[model samples]
Each structure stands twice: as structure tokens, then as C-alpha cells.
Target: MDEVLNFIIAAYPDDTLKELIQIKLSLDKTGTVQVSVSNAGPPVHLDRIPRFEPSAPTESNLDGLWYFLAKNFVDHLEFRNLGMDGWQAVLERRLSAASFEPRKADSEGSIDEEIAQFEVRPGRHDDAAELVDLTYDTYGYSYTGPDFYHPSNLSHHLASGEIVSIVATADGVIVGNTSISYPPETPCCAYLGALMVKRSYRRSKAIELMISETVAPAIGNRP
Candidate 1:
């Protein structure tokens, strides 16, 4: 399950933010497993899975590889179009009740231990400069969005609530950050982006904690 889900995030289209990817997993008494992944990217096509090497590997072509890997664990893969909302991919498999395997527990001092070292909180106006510095270190001025590079702009947005920022800190220094913004036309829905973690801190599960623990809860409290 982690293999398929991790590939889904890693292979997410460069044109879209990873924050937009949504995942759901379920298992039934009949020993059927199901996974649903939804995102605002190109439609999923089973034919896109790579059968052989190609001249160039675009994002769409690489998807073929993900689908191919999924085929090993799932009996069926279904793609559903959601109009302007994008698409969803559903994977399903069935097994004898006795064939189900329990998930392996994490070893001591693994991700949980690493995550305990940092703290997540809402970002302040003063954090703009540090956030910009972190972005520069990660994207090297190549991030497509120009707003984040300007500390003044980011500060203004943060102060005005145009952008809701979350930061993960260790020893009072920022190690990771993410933000949410609402589209003018779609105020009911928030777009999550600008997620970045210090190269040295990527293993701390800061990204997962920021989104699942902080961002989602903050969004729920929105008026």
C-alpha cells in the first residue's frame, strides 16, 4: 500500500502541487481491498503505462510505470473523469479471508521518533524572510511562482490572511513550511502549496505532519 501511494505522490505531475493529491483506503469483511486516489492532473489512461523504453519520458508516460506496478497488487484499475475537478484512479483486489496480511509495525525509533524533534505551528509575518530563504535553498530560484521569492509580498499576504502558512520548527529555526490559498472565484475551496522541507529534515515526516496534523485542521476551522 505504501509503495503504490508513495509512487502516486512521487510521480505527481510537475505542473501540479503535491498537496492537491487526495487518497483513500478501505478494506471489507470479504477480504477486498480498495484504494482511491484523486487529483487535479491529467486523466489517467491505462495505455500510458510503459511497456518498453521510450524516446522521452514525460509525466504521462511515467504514469504507465505506476499503473504497471499497481497491476501486481490489484485485480482491477479504474479511472474516472471528474470534469473540471480532474480525475480519480481506483484500485481493487480480493483475497481469501485467511490470505489477508497484517501490516508490519514500524521498528522502534523510526518515523515517529524523527517527527518528535520538530514542532508545527501557524506562520507569522516575521517568518516570510525565512520562508523565502528555505524556498531558495530548495528550488534555487526555479520555482514557477514568483510571489514566494519576494519576502515583502509573502509577508503582506500572510498578514492579510490571503495565504495561510504553516511552519515546522526545530530549535526555534524553520525546517519546513506549507501554505494554503483560496482562489478568488472559488472561495469555498483552498489550494495547498508552497510545501518545502530543509534537505536535512526531509526524513522527519514533516510534510505529512504539516498537512495531516496542522493544515487540514486549520482548514476545518475556517469561517
Candidate 2:
């Protein structure tokens, strides 16, 4: 009985044990073993709450995103120094000064071979819907407000030629996207946004591929 309990406990990490557990074992005249096992804890439930209901995806953009994160970020921005005017000024200064530290492996990865199965498309369309979903999923609640626009809005910018957008799809799943918008009014440069990848697929080289193929070309760049 002890051996059997040990084996079962080793099998499931979610299983619980109490300091005191009752185990019963019996042997008939034939010398066969019978064992019983029980975990000492509240009943376990594996039901998943449906978070991605119709409410989540019914509209183009989820409105409460900034509100949700602001519950922590901006709400305490004054107390904790997040999103404050000074902080915003500091970040704006940093964003203005930040440069791409282009430490190449000396060579860029091949977009064709790396993202071969994935299609790199110009501008934005209905196809980018899933990439938007991937963005929310990857960054959770942070992909909103002044830092970036919603994925679909980014697509609109791409379609209008207001900005350049590129989305990467692998086997029909939108894994990542890259975008940069240049306004003629702002002559020196523009901003890059919507650069994201799914959490599980981040280990793969998908983001680089998308950047090289979609975003790089949109800005009249050559990799």
C-alpha cells in the first residue's frame, strides 16, 4: 500500500497529501494485493472559465484595456511614480533618444527560410485579426493607450498608407506583426509599433522574420 501510494503521488503534481492519510491493503489466500488511495484536501475542479467570450472579441478594440492596467499603473502613478507627467516626459525623452543597437550576428536571418511557411504581407487586412489577438495574448493587458494602438487600427494605418504594417502567419496562425508609421509632418523619422509575438512562440525567430520582411520593406529598407 505504501509503495502504491508513493507511485501515485509521484505521478501527479496536482495531487495533495495530508499528514495523516488512511490506506488499506488486503491479501486474499491467493496472495494478491489490493490498495486504495485518497488525497486529503478540498475537491479538485478543472473547469476552465470562458474569458474569451463574445464580450471580448465582439468589437474591434476592447475599450477597458487602458482602464484595467491604469487601475494599477496610472491610479498609482502619482504614489508610485508611474505614468506621471514627469515620468511621461522622461519616457518621451528616452523614446526620442533610444537607438537600435544593431549588433548583428554579422548577418540577418533569412526571412524565406525562417518564416518560409508563414506569409509576410504588406499593409493590413482582415487577415491581421488573429495577429491582433496574438498581441493581446502575448502582452496581456499592456498593449494599449499612448504606447501603441490596437492591431486593427494599426492595419487601418497600413491600408491608408498612413503607416506600413507587416504580419507574420505560420500555418494560418498569426504569430507576430511589425509596423512603422511615418508622417510627412514629422520629417526626421517616425515610430515603430505593434512589434509583438506570441508568448509560446517567442523562442522561435518569427519576430525577426516579420521585422525584416514586412516592417523593413515598408520603410524602403533592404535586409
Candidate 3:
């Protein structure tokens, strides 16, 4: 029976496509075996590796570096790649849930002609896709379309809970939109976002109606 041993073999980082070899042993007159030359290997300086350094990340050098010294091998590695697609997906989905954009047809130069109707209620989550398009179309925003809400990352808040929404229909079409984040934390904390109306919806009083209708009800829920 022979002894099984494991050892690390270090090669110059510049070259890789080589095989690792093991050295043999020799015997002396006293029957003692020696393997000094075979045991000697290269010295490792672990501190030189970039990963273990004391440097803060910058916009340029955000990628941290690292090096290692194994039994007989040295390794250099770098880690600095993150994906933005996932983040954009999240942002778009959130925008879909919160953003509201309504368009108006005729600019009557006053609030009376613009506002077709006003409603104080939650934004319709079931029709988010349609609302997203309506909002985008009203604003004249040239996007590929709304951030697609695929089922893979569907959010519950936008689905289960309701958000305060104000809708103004102009000439039988929803022309203005507003929304407020609900389920207030800290008894009075509310978030407002994604408030938009089309250029054609330029009426001073309509803005007041949207602001009042969307915000007033939720705060009333507090006390």
C-alpha cells in the first residue's frame, strides 16, 4: 500500500495549457529516504492580490480585486459585474403600478371645459396595462410601450391593496390621472408619485380637483 497525498501546483499566470508533474524520492546508506529538492516550491505573496487591498470603490474602480496563495498555487480574481436589466424591470413594474397619465382633447382655456368627470377611488390595478398605455399616450411619450408586466415578477402591493387615485374624463375619455401610495406607515406617512396629465388637459381647476380627490380620502383614513 502507498500513501495518497494532495499538493497544489503553481504555474506562471501567463501560461496555462501545461500538465502538472510529481517528483520521486531517493534512498540513503542508512536506509533513510530524503526528498528535499522535491519538497521545495515557489514562495507566495498573498498581500499583492487586489481583493485583499484597502481601497474604497469609485465610479471608475468599483471592481474590487483579490489574490490567493494555496499550498503551491496562486490565483488572481476580480469581481465587478452586475446586471441592469433586472433593476429596470423592477422600476418599470413599479411605474406601471403607480404612474398615471391622462389626456384631454379640447383646451377650453379654463377648467370647466377640460374636466369631464372626477372620481375619488383606488387606481384600477386590474386594468394596469390599459391605464399604462392611456397615460403614455396622453403624455406623448415615445416609449417602446409601457414597462411590460410579465407574471414572473408580479408585485402583490399593486395587486392586492388599493391606492388612492383621481381620474378626470374629458369628453367621455379619461383625460387626467393622479395616485397616492396607500397603507400609510407611521400613522401619517404617505407617498405620492407618478402624477401626470396630458398637455391638452391644461386647466387650473382640474389640477385642483385631482390633487384634492386623490389625497384627501387616504389621509382621512388615518384619524
Quote each prediction's TM-score: 0.45, 0.40, 0.35
Query: Ranking under lDDT, best-scoring first?
Result: 1, 2, 3
For each candidate, the alpha-carbon lDDT, in order, equals 0.73, 0.49, 0.40
In terms of lDDT, the poorest run of 10 residues in model 3 is 85-94
Clashing pairs in 3: 50-65, 51-65, 51-66, 102-175
Candidate 3 residue-wise lDDT, 88-188, digit = tens: 00000012133334444465444554344554344445545545655565555543323313221112344644344456655545556665555535436
lDDT of 3 at 109: 45
Off by over 4 Å in 2: 1-116, 144-152, 184-188, 214-223
- For model 2 the local lDDT of residue 67 reads 27
Relative to the unseen true structure, what is the C-alpha lDDT of residue 29 in candidate 1, on a scale of 0 to 100? Answer: 69
Q: How much does candidate 1 score in TM-score? A: 0.45
Q: In model 1, how large is the Cα lDDT of residue 85?
A: 81
User: Which residue pairs show collisions in model 1?
Assistant: 49-64
Residue-wise lDDT of candidate 2 within 1-223, one digit each (tens)? 3333343344354644442344444433343433333444332221321222334554433432332333233212111122222111010011223334444441344244444466666645554457557667667668653323365665565556656667677777776777666765875776677677765556667776776775343254412
> Residue 195 lDDT in model 1?
77
Q: Candidate 1: where are CA atoms >4 Å away? A: 1-116, 183-186, 220-223
